[model samples]
Target chain A: MSTGAVIEFTSISKRFGGVAAVKDLSFTVEPGRVTGFLGPNGAGKTTSLRILLGLVAASSGTATFGGVRYRDLPHPLKTVGAALEAASFHPGRTARDHLGVYAIAAGLPRTRVMEVLTLVGLAAHAAQRVGGYSLGMRQRLGLAYALLGDPGVLVLDEPINGLDPEGIRWIRGFLRDMAAEGRTVLVSSHLLSEVQQSVDDVVIIARGELVHLGPLSSLDTDAAPQTIVESPDREALAAALTAAGITFSIGRTGLLAATGDPALLGHLAFTAGVELSVLHRQKAGLEDSFLALVGGGHTL
Target chain B: MTMFLRSVSAEFAKIFTTRLWWILAIVLFGYIGLLAGGLAALFAGIQTGVISPDAVNTGGGPTDFGSLPPLIYSFASSVGYVFPVLLGALATTGEFRHQTLTPTFLATPRRGLVLGAKTVTLVLIGAGFGVVALAASVGIGGGVLSAFGVDALLQGAETWLLVARTLLAMGLWAAIGVGLGALVPNQVASIVIVLAFTQFVEPLLRLAASFLEVTAKIGNFLPGAASDALVGASVFTMASPAGTAPLDWWQGGLVLLGYALIATVIGYAVSWKRDVT
Candidate 1:
């Protein structure tokens, strides 16, 4: 990995017709980190990335690469490589020829095509037409294209969508390796668990608005742990917490609530004559933190 | 300059990588050869009194039997015109259709530069289509004409002039197609307009105007007519009413160029302002 340039989006907003697709969205992706841009469907993740790539115009604000606009980059491919989707390819073209077109446009030598294909593990299928490629293969080819410039900054949108578990693992490690080398990698995904494993930092958005932006660990994890307490007398446990002025919410198979320590809750339950069957601290993972910030759903 | 070269090279690779152009190339060659050969055989029958010359003239053919050879050769452009149009439309619209334009625009951020590169690349390939059309029409049609005892006139300077003009005309058709494709990136609609206008609608309009005194003059400015006047060998030239001199070759070239220029300019305007998404 190499030290990569910072990607800055300052107050970026994009409107389609009268609908506000992205409104006043602002964040910065720093060097040497794998940043996950997690958002729900229609949350403007793709739109923001498109604006950064200059594929779509921003209704307001600026997206800059190292403080330079993408269009103004002397050699764009050399600075930032982006893959919005795996299907943005010509089906009739073979993998090598498809990359060859970009190679020519970027003024890169033909050998770079093969190198990137090998990097993405598509070298064996390089001669095969993209029409015959499976969804996983197309995803690999898309990644191969993004890496063709050997760019310091990579922006991929839902790159893991069609990959198998092994391929997903490969990409997770690949992105980590890229960031480990100090290359800036911003991957947009709606899958919270997948992103949690792959990213060091996360910038989450909901309804086209920035929900939270910070390191993945900075997401409400250290504040206090949620305690899942189950009792033979569930109503007694709930009543005990309520009388004691400790708020509790009923959860599946338990009375769920957040507290500073499980020991305090355990002592309170014993004194209240609420026989506790289960009491344990539930560690908040990225998925839980993301759901807390963006609202509850199975995935971000 | 080097960037432009690279862009053009990419366009060439794009064209060759797909089976689209070569398939159209074969269509252009085979269609022109088959049509021109059939016309030569018809003229041979007319010369032998097997078919009435009057019958051919009524069907929008030349009245003078001697003009049939050049007319048939010039018909090569008429027969081969759609392929270039299809080629140009598919070249640009294929990008949008396949969503490959995202990467294309990403690789080369200047949209105008990308479009200009397409124009340059298509012109040469369009001219190459012209060469193929010319070869097939002359090779097959001339042989048929000679076998029928008509003077094929393959050696004449006029014959070569028609060939050169045919090449130029086909190139212009391709330029127009590129412009149209750019103007309307929708593949189905572009293909529809090209086929409907060039194949049937324009020819009917030309024939209808040829019958009138006032409208005949205005019809000369039509793209198909201008292209025919440029080539100096359209079947419409014979059908044109007497005493009205159609546009000279130079004027016809300008008119054809004007359409390409207008279409491209407007296409560029829309493309420059619109988002690719």
Candidate 2:
């Protein structure tokens, strides 16, 4: 298998008429890892992917696979495989016929079509027309098309949207396995939760601008961790937290402390002679942090 | 060169895999066969004195028995040309309708090459449609003419020349369809334009232009007229005043080609290069 190349988007922007669809977006996806491109609806994720694949012209800046633009690549399909969000098959064509068209156009062997069909678990349905395919089967067929050339880099948009839970689970492992083979995998979804477990790193965008780009774990670090603390002496606990210069807010369950370390709060409470019934570290959920980073107004 | 050949092959595959091509060809066959056979029988009946010209009221009827064979053969291009045009337009518009251009561009990054391959493929398929159409017109129409005691003239070189020219005309019509479809990627809009222009707009314009000497000269340049001129005969053109002459065959071919080229170039510049998504 060919190893993945770095996918780089440098200061890319696209405007349709006067409306800016993508604005000064820049990021790089490294090889041997799955990168989740998370964004809200109409956040220009599809446009960015399209630009990277040379389907859309960027208003300014460049997107390249490794060091070369997608259009300039001599063997584009061999180097990179892309399935856009709106990429669709002709309903009249059978799955095999659909892949066969690309395979022939790209000069790939006919056997590759069957190989990829089996890879995506669509071997049995290869003879069936796409008009009869369910959404999940269509998604698999798209993946099969992406794998036809056994490309080093795979780019899929909203790959898990209509999958059953089992299908979603299968894809998560499939993505990881592809990355494990040293291929760069960039999967996009509007909901972070959809890809939270599958992705090692994330490139989050909202309203056409990059909000965050780093390891998935790093996103949590930016969010200030809190501790949920409570006691029978609620008033005394509040007074103790105030005297200790630690910020605290009352919640339905307890006083929400500004400290991440529960032990520190416990020690402070002990020193203040406040009997604490509860003192636990509250880890910020990645979903909450994702919404906060992008502003909580839009639905994921 | 190999890549281009593969692209063309892929385009051919794209068309054959769908039922639309054969469906349209069958329709063309049936439609042209019935009309050509019916007309050949009626005209041959009059020429042979079996049916009175007065009863038909064809204005003393066709006096040129020699022109009948070529005229009937030309029906493949003159009347049945729309099938190939519709086929070609649908091929391009279907890509846009199904959003298949995404994968197409992904496989072949050079947009120009894809368009070129489509043009070449559609031209060939259009010629194939021409063959089916001619099979009907020449086979059924010739049989009818022979049965009515009018010479079928199937063995004549002129008749074969008309057949070849009809094939060429249909291929060019297909190219024009591709150009129009590329120029208007919307399926419904492209189809509407094709039907409206071919069935209503151009025919009316051609009829209206034939009334005036100055306009008649210009009318010969219209796609349908040029196609008829290329085929060397047309039932519709037989109604026009004899003073309004058709252009030479090669000139007619060039005029048809010019229409295809202009539409393709403008479409390439305006829409083909635009963002597909």
Candidate 3:
């Protein structure tokens, strides 16, 4: 893309007391794409988002927008639309008033409040007090507040949290559409699978470090040449493949080989008179990389 | 949308839309009614010969100082206005209660602007309470006096002057509360100390100060005494049971205003520089 909001973090580190919440963490969030900020709890995902928003100062390094820190931006709300935590509203304020304040702060017209309220499906309930709003409604309100000025870059921390199934689907579709419009969308969540299909590029962080940062397509294990052989005469088939200098292992049901293509493995199976029972190639789901990135303690 | 003005607007919105804010409003109005009733009864007993003519002649008469002046209006401003002061303080401190500070900071990144907004709104709320309390105090005090046959108490230009000064004094007391709100951002601590200072501490100090006239003179500079000079009566330097000091009205006003300014500035400093979220 020729243009979009480019968020770059260089050697960013933040420490609460002696414990390093995020230590020497650095990554570039690109433009016009959904960058998934995947991390487990206490993995500094929230902390890093805070630093980017300037809620917490970094011990070292910088997180810049275009090339400037968020605080340094001439108009922060117009430059970066951010939804950090959903419960940002004053409990007594109505949903409309809640967004009204932010819209005014962003120097946008007051009507923007109504527009955003409607955009987030909150128009009908705009008069309801935030104290009585459901968690799903609060999340929508948070998004409305963030989108008050329609900033180019959206930085959301666990925006899908507490959303119902329908809310989740709507959010995924909305985020995809926003990114499709050549806007940079950086959203973080504990559930990797939730964003697995939504995001174009993934940036997973574990224990305050970047574990992986690349496109999802690169993780297609199915495209990696794999071989399969099945036989009714399993014992004989295994021995014959070994004798033919084919490195294969006893798969869950059939036999798996590295050197033999599916067709070649089929021919070998026919020559041995072993009736083929099963043969298939496997693709790597996001689950494999997810568990590989975050362990059991934070997987939940 | 200057950062400063935006912050002030947000602060107003935050304080305006809370049950705690409305509770404070209720307490203010309710307290004003009580103080008016108390002042009325105190004046009535004096008029009905409960106190000797000696007390009446020295401007404590059933009708001599019978009118509720600006200073009296200060005392009567709001019985429960202190709650809003507590509310404003807690609003700032409550950011620490939940994880809400993170989102607030995201919305308005500059902490100083946010604090300034709070300061402005607190001052406004204090002023608002002051106005309501002043109106109620004057109206009820006058009604009580008239009902008890002391209608001629403020029979000249003095009565009108009392009304105007009472409004100004009410306004001043509101500012003083705002200052206190800023100086102490903790709800319980600030409310307790402010309420205690007004009721127990100031009254006690004035009583003790009158025992030593010089000390009473010094005590007259305290906020309660200063506001009393502007409203109705001050216990610190007057011959009342509260205490006796020789402080004139202007001196007391200056002292209270000084405290309000100092508290407000310090509150802004603490909130602006420190981490709010």
Best by TM-score: 2
Provide the clash count, candidate 3.
11
Scored by TM against the true chain B, the candidates give 0.93, 0.97, 0.75
The DockQ for candidate 2, computed on C-alphas, is 0.80
Candidate 1: clashing pairs of residues: A1-A181, A2-A181
- The worst-scoring run of ten residues by lDDT in candidate 2 chain B lies at B58-67
Residue B124 local lDDT, model 1:
84
Per model, how many backbone clashes are there? Answer: 2, 0, 11
Best by DockQ: 1
Candidate 3 displacement at residue A210 in angstroms: 3.0
Query: What is the docking quality class of candidate 1?
Result: high
Q: What is the TM-score of each candidate against the true structure?
A: 0.92, 0.94, 0.84
**Interface RMSD of the predictions, in order shown?**
0.7, 0.8, 2.6
Query: 2 or 3: which has the higher DockQ?
Result: 2
Q: Which stretches of candidate 1 lie over 4 Å from their true place?
A: A1-3, A221-224, A229-260, A263-279, A295-300, B48-63, B241-243
Selected candidate, larger lDDT, 1 vs 2: 2
**Candidate 2: stretches off by over 4 Å:** A229-255, A264-279, B59-66
Please give me the total number of clashing residue pairs in predicted model 1: 2
lDDT of 2 at B64: 51
lDDT of 1 by residue, A1-300 (tens): 224899999999999999999999999999889999998888899999999999899999999989999999888888898988889888999999999999999998899999999988989999999999999999999998888888999999999999999999999999999998889999999877877887888999988899998888788565666788989998888888888787777889687776757898899888998899999977767677788777778352
Report the C-alpha lDDT of model 2 over B89-151, residue by residue, as the tens digit: 898889889999999999999999999999999999999999999999999999898898888
